[model samples]
Target: MRDCNIIKDLLPLYKEDLLSNESKTFVEEHLKTCPECENLLNEEIEIESKNTKPLDFVERRIKKETRYFTLAVLALIGSILIFIISYLNTPRHIEYDKDLYKVYRNDKIYTVEFADKVSGIDYTDTEDAIYLDAYSTKYDEIFNKRRLRKSLTFRKENLKTVLYQNHESMPNMVIGSGEIHQTLLPRLFLGFYARLSIIGFIGLTLILFLIEKFRKKAISLPIKTLLIGAPLSLFLGIIAIKGFNTATYYPVTDFKYIVLLSLGIYLFFIFISIFKEQKRM
Candidate 1:
C-alpha cells in the first residue's frame, strides 16, 4: 500500500495508543512530513471535538432564562390570586333600596351614605348631573366592612343633580331638581366592544392562516400572534366580566378586570415554559 494509505490505516490505532511504538513512530513521522495527512488528522480532531461536547442550542437558551424561573413562577401564582380576589371583590348591580342608602343635603352640598350590605358604588357624570349605581358581591355583602359608613360627598354647585340609577333604565330615583336628563345605557358601548373583539379575533385568525397557506412571503409571527391574542383576550375578558345577555352598569371597571386577567394568563405560560426547560435539564 502507499505510505499515506498505510499511515491512514494506522491513524485510529495511533490515536488510542494501541499501535506498537515502532508503528506509532512511523505514522508520526509521516504526519510530520505529509501536509495532506497532517490536514486530515486535524480535521478528524475537530470533528471529534464537535461530536463530544454539548451541542444543544436550546440548552444555551435555557441557561439564559434559568435565573428568571423562580420569578416567573411567583408572578404566575400571584396573578392567579389577584384574578380570584378581583372577582370576589367585584360588585355587580344591585336593586335600589332607600334603606340601603340615604341622600341628604348639608351646607347646600349633598351626601349619600351606604349601609354595610351595599359594598360598592359606580357612577357617571354628565353636564350638570350625576348618574349613580350601587353594587355588591356575595363576599362584600356578607363579610366586607367597606360599605359601612361609606359616604360620597358631591359638590352641589355646578353639578347639582344626583340620580340613583338602581338598574338599567327608568323609574330610577332623582335627588335634586326633577329635570329629566336622558340616561344612556352603558351596555351599548361595552357590548359593542365585546362583539367587535370576538369578530376581529376570528378575522385575524383567518388572515394568519391564509398568509401561511399560499404566500411566498412569510407572515411575521409576533405581529400576527399579538393581533390574534389581543382581541381573543378582550373577548374572553368581557365575557368574564359581564355576561353578553345584558349590559353591565360599570363599563370601565369591566375593562380593567379583563386586562388584569390576561396578564396573569401570560405569566402562567412563562412559568410553565421555564418549568419544562428545567425538567429537560
Candidate 2:
C-alpha cells in the first residue's frame, strides 16, 4: 500500500505547481489507491487557494506606496520653482560709491579708467567728496583729456613710484590732481562688482539645488543645473566684475579671470554629484 504520509509531503509542491511531471504522476497514482492520502492532497490544494488572496493584496499595497512617493517628489519641485521666482524678482540695492575716497586713497588699490566716460570724485573743503562726473556730459570732456597724467603713485616716506597705466584697461576716467592720481591705483576697488555678482549667482545656484533635492527625480537635474547655472553665473560674474571695476575705478585682469574660472570648476563637481544620485535610483 502506498504510504499516505509520503504523498502528504509532495502535496504542497504539487499545489504550488512546483512538482516535476514524473513526481506528480507518481503522487497522484498513490493518492487514488489510498483514501487517506487522497483526502490529504485535497486538503493541501484548498489551503494553497486561500494563500493567493493575501499575496495579491500585498502587491497592490506596494504599488500604491510607489505612486505616493512619486507625487511627493513632484510637490517638492513645485515649491522650489516658487522660491526661485520670488528670489529673482526681489530688488537688491547696488551700492556704487559709498566711502568713495577711502578706496581712492588706499595704496593697496588698483585703478582703471574708461576711454568714453569720465568718472571722478570732486573734493570740496566742506562736504564729503561728490561723484561729479557721474552719468553727465562733464564726464566726457574730463575723460577725453589725453594730456592728463594717467598713472598711479605709490609713496613710501621720501620715496615714490609711478606705475604707467593704459586707458584702455582703466575702469573709468578721473579728473584728480597729481596727488589724487598718484593715490588712485592703490586705493581703487579691483573687483567690487564682480564679488557682488558672484554672491548673487551663488544665491541663484542654491535655489536650483533646493529644487533638485525636492524633485528627487534625478533624471537630468544636475546636468541641467550646470548647463543653466554655469553660463548664467559666468555672465553675471563678468557683469559684477565690470561693475566693481567701474565703481572702484579699475580694470579687469588675469586675477579676476582666474576667480571666475575657479567658480566654474566648482560648479562642475556639484553637477557630478547630482548625476551620481540619479544613477543610483
Candidate 3:
C-alpha cells in the first residue's frame, strides 16, 4: 500500500511525461499490477482526448490566434513606449551657449533659463557642485522647437560650482566655479541597480533550479514554473529598458519602461502557462 501511494503520488508527473526514465519505468511496472490506478489514468486520458477533438481544435485555434494577436499587440505597444520614454529620458548638452542660457539669483534661489522645446531636464547635484542638462526627444527637437522661456531653480544651500557638462565627453563649462568641496555621481540614474536586479534574480533562480534538480524535494511544481517564467520576464523587462547599458540619466523614466515591458511579459506568460501542465503538490 505504501508503494502504491508513492506511485500514485507520482502519477501526475508520469502523465505529463515529466518523470526521469528510471521513474517512468518504475511507474509503468506498477501500473501493470495496479488495475485501479491504471483505470484512473485511462479515464483521464480519455477525457483529455475528448478535449482535443475537432471541435476542441477549433476552439484551440481561436485561442491560439487570440494569444498571438494579444502578444503581438503587447510587444508593439511595449516597444513604442520604451522608445518614447527613453527619448524623453535622455539628456542633450545645452552646450553652454552664452546667449541661450542665463543664470540669476534672487534671495538665494538660483534659476537657469531653457528653451520651451526642452520637455524635460536632468541634473547632477554634489555637496558643492551642480550639473544641468536639457531633455527632449530628437523628434521633439526637430518639430517642436518653439523657444519659449523656461527656468529651473536651485536652493541656496544646494548651489555651488555650477557646470553644464557636455555628457561624459568634453570639459564642463563653469557657470559658477565656486570653491570646490566634493564630487559625486548623478543622484538620478539607472547606474548599477538595474544590472544588479537582473543578475540577482537570475542567479537566485539558477540556485533554486539546481537545488531542485539535485536535492530531490526542495520546491514544488508551482515554484519551479515561476522560477522559469517570472525571472525571465523580469530580465526581459530590465533589458527592454536598459538593454545591457550600465546607466541612464533618468532612473524614474527608465522605471516606467520596466513596468510597461513587464506588463507585456506578464501577458505573454499568462498564455504560455496553458502549455505547462501543473502537477499536484
Candidate 4:
C-alpha cells in the first residue's frame, strides 16, 4: 500500500475529480486496502458538507435582502403618490352662495333657509363642527359660488345655531350657520408647516439622497429612516396648513383623516424595512 501522506495529498484532487485517470486508479486501489486513508477521506467529505451549509444560508440571506429592497422601493413610490393625491384633494376653504342662504330671525333660534336651486358647486364635506359668521358687508358676486360663503373666528359661546330649510340637500354642511366660531379640526402648533409641506418633503428626500451619495459606507439605515419620515412630515404639514388662522376658512376636520392614512402607510413601510434589516443582520 502507498504511504498515507501520498494518499492524503491526492485525496483533495480525487474529491474534486481533478486527478489523472492513472493517479485516480492508484488512489482508489490504495483506499480499498487502507482503512486509515478511507476514514481520512470520509472526514474531509463531512467537513466540506458542513461548510456548504453556511454558504446556503448566506445565499438565502441575499435573496431575502433583495426582496426587502424591492418592497421598500415600491413603498417609497406609493408614499409620493399618496402625498400628491392628498394635496390636490384637500379643500382650500369653505364657500357658499350668499343669495341661496336667507337669514330669518325666530324666537331665540335663527333659521337660515338655503335655496334648493343652487347647483354645480363642489363643496367640501362637513365636520362635527364648523365656523359660522353673519357678514353685514355684501361680497361681490362672482361666477364661482364658493367665494360667496363667509367665515368668522370667535369663541364658541358667541356662535349661534342657525337652523336650515331643505336640510336634506345641505345635509350636515358647516356653512349657513349664523356664527363662524364653531371648531372644525383640532388646532396644530406647526400650522405654517402645512403651507410648504410638499416642498419640505421634496427637499428632505433630495438631502438624504445626497448624504447617501457622499458617505463612503452604506447609508441604507439613513435612507430607510428618510423613507419612513416622509409621510409623517407631509401629514404634519397638512394639519399645520389646515389649522393656521386665515380670513377664509380651511377645513381641518374634513381632511384630517388623510393625515392618519399617510401615517399608517409610513408605519407599515417602517416595520417592513426594520424586519428586513434585522433578518439581514
| Model 1 error, position 52 (Å) | 6.1
Worst 10 residues of 4 by lDDT: 133-142
- lDDT per residue for candidate 1 within 1-281, as digits (tens), equals 39999888888788778998899899988988999998888888889888889868867776666665666668568768867766786667777665878878877677788777776678787775677777778676666655456678877666656777756456355576565656645566767887888898899899888888888675553345446767776666667777665376677776677667666554555555556655654
**In what order do the candidates fall by lDDT, top score first?**
1, 3, 4, 2
Residues 48-158, model 2: lDDT tens digits: 678755687677766755654554455345435533432332222122342222213445543433222223322212132222222213323444445332223333333
Q: What's the CA error at residue 79 for candidate 1, in Å?
A: 4.5
Model 4 over residues 1-281: C-alpha lDDT tens digits?
A: 34788999999999999999999999999999899999999999999998777677788988877777676676666766765555444443223455646655544444444443332232222443333322221122223345434322223344434322221134233324344433434334334445456566677677777876898556666355646366555555454434434222323434464464455457456646655675667
TM-score, candidate number 2? 0.30
| Candidate 4 residue spans exceeding 4 A from truth | 1-3, 53-71, 88-240, 243-257, 260-280
For candidate 4, the lDDT comes to: 0.53
lDDT, residue 266, model 1: 47
Relative to the unseen true structure, what is the C-alpha lDDT of residue 66 in candidate 2, on a scale of 0 to 100?
Answer: 64
63-180, model 3: which lDDT tens digit per residue? 7766655655664566566556555544443544556567777887878877566666667775656666665566567665775666777777745677665545443544566443
Instruction: Report the alpha-carbon TM-score of model 3 versus the true structure.
Output: 0.48
Which runs in model 1 stand beyond 4 Å of their true positions?
Answer: 1-52, 56-58, 61-75, 105-109, 127-129, 137-143, 146-148, 154-161, 168-171, 174-184, 215-227, 265-281
Clashing pairs in 3: none
lDDT of each: 0.71, 0.45, 0.64, 0.53
Highest-scoring model, lDDT? 1
What are the RMSD figures for all models against the true structure? Answer: 7.5, 17.3, 16.9, 12.1
lDDT of 3 at 122: 67
Using lDDT as the yardstick, the better of models 1 and 4 is 1
